[model samples]
Target: MVDRFVEGAEAHAMMDRLARKYLGSERFEWLMPGEERIAVIVRPTKVRHIVGVERFRPGGPVPAS
Candidate 1:
């Protein structure tokens, strides 16, 4: 995940994106009670698969993962 703090225009843009995604409908807009907003950006990390199922079965040897 992307672990970092953001500010300025970038943060504002992100906030709008979040608002659209979370409170898209007009009915849901009421849920947004505050003028100011917070945005969070999460980047997916590479999935490192150390071991696959093929390495282990029934009584087969279990590979180190």
Candidate 2:
């Protein structure tokens, strides 16, 4: 899941420190928009690769790699 929050640098710095401390180095990723916002990416514990396939193929099965 990805989420964005509108906050100033202080809030962003606080969240970044907490995230780094608790989430560790591999569980998630985040970015600061350089303004007044932050973007956080929460990934699945088990990763998957789906590079090429028809994403808009509704009701169709995903292509095997």
Collision count for each candidate, in order: 0, 0
RMSD in Å for all candidates = 12.5, 12.4
Computed on alpha carbons, the lDDT of every model, listed in order, comes to 0.58, 0.57
lDDT of 2 by residue, 3-62 (tens): 444356656666677666666553235563554555455556677769895466775444
- In terms of TM-score, how similar is model 1 to the real structure? 0.35
Candidate 1 lDDT by residue in tens digits, 1-65: 87776765677676666555555633324334555544566777886667654545776454445
Off by over 4 Å in 2: 1-7, 26-65
Candidate 1: stretches off by over 4 Å: 25-65
Ten residues in sequence with the least summed lDDT for candidate 1: 25-34
RMSD of 1: 12.5
